[model samples]
Target: MLPALSEKELDRLEDLLITYGNDYSVLNLAELNGFFTALASSPNRVNPEQWLPAVAGGKVPKFKKPAHEEAYTALMLRYASQVAEELADDPEHFEPLFEQSEGEEGPTIILEEWCFGYMRGTQVAEWSELPPEQDRLLKAISLHGLEDNFELLDSMSFDEHQACVPLVVEAAQGLYQYQKQHRH
Candidate 1:
């Protein structure tokens, strides 16, 4: 499976996002990856008009430098285009982008933030219920997203989700396939 971004690109992208400030800045690199991955299988082209403002917290962002603006736009376009291509060519093997990040709050937090991106990305375009074939994956990502309770998880569930990581990876791939096959 193709990786969404090289380690260096991922690091550079993360740094750029953080420097720019907005929803992108709030999320860690893993979350950023998860969000874009979710959007990869969308039937529609990833709409910069919609996402730039969303990433900027619903307001138009003004970049400090023209170079930063160019980099941000180029990086986002590459992310969307490359992810879709990867999902189409090798959905089963596409690597998850979470490993690029090393956050203090650990995997759970990363998972939670990733879902935030997933949920948000999916909503950027109009969509209905997923196909019956994808129900398991839908439920998995939805449940994972909802796991964002204000309180921290107790020890058992925490380990459970950590162990569930493989399933999450598979589900994400399944989701990519489902979206591709059932395009509206």
Candidate 2:
């Protein structure tokens, strides 16, 4: 079993991400987790510089702070190992990070950010041959209709999002397996 970064390590990393301004949806550790997870599951390696801007919704962040880079590197190493180990063990337990902060917007907002990152990663990798199920899941994630219907989203319950969690995991696990040999 690949162990997660300890609470202390995670805490420090989380703080680092939180301190970094949310230029992209990539500020919080959860979004970073999304970014790394998408990269690992891609069939080809993607350069960070190529896709970081895409994840930011096409906005080039003015700054690439070293501290943010360090924090991101830490999560990448840890999350990639975790993905490999999890795919080898039980993909059923695989879960993306979707952090919930007090007084924050609904959980769906993070879902959009995570999915947005995931889709951007796939695009950057030029993963052209995703199987149908995985493709369906990817499309589903990218079109959650969060921003399209904000008034309803403001009071949306998380139940719908929770229901899709398994599907997301299954798709991620599938992608991981399909890309495993190419990854390492």
Candidate 3:
């Protein structure tokens, strides 16, 4: 099994992403986690050739050194593999890397970026026309991730959105199991 990314490595990856300079298009760490989780759960394999460019906001970054580029790419591939292994071996304990912010009440869990990343992954994987049951499972992530659902989400109170977090997690795990059982 590939080693998990250390905190320092993770930070370095984040820095590399930040250096990409297209804030609107580039994904952050949380989004990358969600994106990778979706790809990991996908029934059809999505190669690095397809997904790696998306990591850099739809363009491959031109690193200063060939070694630096190789290192970051290797790190990303390893992280993606780590996500897949965790979901396959221990879906129950799999966790999405959501952000936490201190709200007036307390620390608030933010699922937006992660969810958005996941939805993007689905798009990249071309996961279209799933069965109703599977579509339902995907919806759990979409509710929190998609821009189209913002109005609906806006209608929900903070507590309500907070309550839905577990549902999203469960949905991701369920999707992984479904794909595992029904892989083509």
Candidate 4:
């Protein structure tokens, strides 16, 4: 189990998963949800494999390529852990606005809508106002989509982070369309 993560961190991780899963039909829904749930319960290390079925709960979607699924899951968890590590310095002041929708279809809708809002907020708000990791994630999400853009080991900057708002927004919209067309 992992400790609770901020809303921004979770959103960023979701954006990355969505982008990486762009090539696959089912998206990294289970992985993302499981990661968050695990984090909420305990901040211990998260193993993507162990977490997958728990997150998917047997309804896991099959991707066109097995490698894609593995890759997406790995990247999503890796980045999420990275976010948690960076923010660990601030424990008392982190929680972001969260609204978990209900039912089997709830996660899909929540993910799509939240990503959309995150991107929009990044744009309307000042760069300095956004978190450093968020800005980088947004920029990466904007240019290459979060999937292709985020380099797990790379360092991020505040400026690059702030500039990612539009990119994140664009990526979120793309994801929304994908989800809409592939209703669960």
Candidate 5:
């Protein structure tokens, strides 16, 4: 019942975070609004298995091999930086992305809808068999105030993970959204 952000919107927000150091109010608003999760689920209506791998590659750096996980993180950060730089210069484009309140002091309909949609979609995914570690990371990304603990990911507090936390998060979101859309 909640409105959702398209995949493109999440990508834009992520880019904003990468450039603005994740401290910007707009970035926080976007995450709090559940833009990323909504975006993840958007493509699933079209294809399930195929879309998972693709968006996973874009959102999280590591999905499969552990050895290359660092490279994946670097790539994600680099992409985020590029996106941030692009977004910073374009006030017209970026302002709307941040514009949840009307007339500068009204209710934030888009943000509220985005949050609701994200929660619904994520809950649906959690009921299924998605990886726990990955789900945690994705939740961090989708929700404001959640941090990505690189230290925890780098070390093995639990079973030795083949994929880094971010990678798993990305892959799980992909799989969850895919399954949600394609399920019979």
Candidate 6:
């Protein structure tokens, strides 16, 4: 099994992603986590080559050095592998790496970026229509992830948004289990 990313390596990876510049739609760390989680839990295996380009928007970034490119790819692969192993070993304990910020009430868990990443994963995986129950699970994620849901989310109270966190987590775990059970 690949070792989990250390804090230092995560910081380095984040820096590398930023270097890709605004021209590309590179995902931030939180979004990458969500993206990898979705792919890892997918019912069908998605080749790394197929999904790697999606990491940097739609095209692979040109690295300054071959070593840099290799390192960047390694970091991403290890991180993705770690996410998969965590879910496979203990789905009940798997957690999305949502960002948190201090709020008037308490720490506010930011779900938008992560949810967006997960949605992207589904798209890249070309997920087909699922059963109603499974679709409901995905909806829990899209509620916060998709841009169209922003207005609805804006209308919700802080507490209401907070309440959705568990639902999203439950949705992720449920999806993983569903894929495991239904894998072709």
Write down the lDDT of every candidate, Cα atoms only.
0.66, 0.61, 0.85, 0.40, 0.38, 0.87
- The clash numbers for all candidates, in the given order, read 0, 0, 0, 13, 2, 0
* TM-score, one value per model: 0.78, 0.65, 0.93, 0.32, 0.23, 0.95
RMSD values, in order shown: 3.8, 4.9, 1.5, 17.0, 18.7, 1.3
Superior candidate under lDDT, 1 versus 4: 1
Query: lDDT tens string, model 2, 62-118?
Result: 546876766656554675566546556765566776655444444442465566556
- Which candidate's TM-score is highest? 6
Model 1 agreement with the true structure over 1-184: per-residue lDDT tens digits = 3346677876777787677666344345666666677777666656778776665556555878898888777776677677667667788898766542444546342366666667667776655776676777766665556555434334446556676577677888988877777665
Stretches off by above 4 angstroms in model 2 are 1-3, 47-76, 100-110, 145-158, 181-184
Per-residue alpha-carbon lDDT of model 5 for 110-168, expressed as tens digits?
32233333444354334344467545644543442223444553454232332233333
Model 1 clashing residue pairs (backbone): none
Name the best candidate (by lDDT): 6
- Better lDDT candidate (3, 4): 3
Clashing pairs in 2: none
What is the per-residue lDDT of model 4 for residues 30-111, given as tens digits with 9 covering 90 to 100? 3343234224223134344544443333334466778766655665565456534533444334332233445443331123
Residues 1-184, model 3: lDDT tens digits: 8998999988887877777637545457888889999998887889999998887778788789887798878888888887888888899888888989999869899989899989988888888677898899899999988899999998998899899899889988888888877666
Residue 69 CA error for candidate 5 (Å)? Answer: 49
How would you order the candidates by lDDT, starting with the best? 6, 3, 1, 2, 4, 5
Error of 3 at 93 (Å): 2.0
lDDT of 6: 0.87
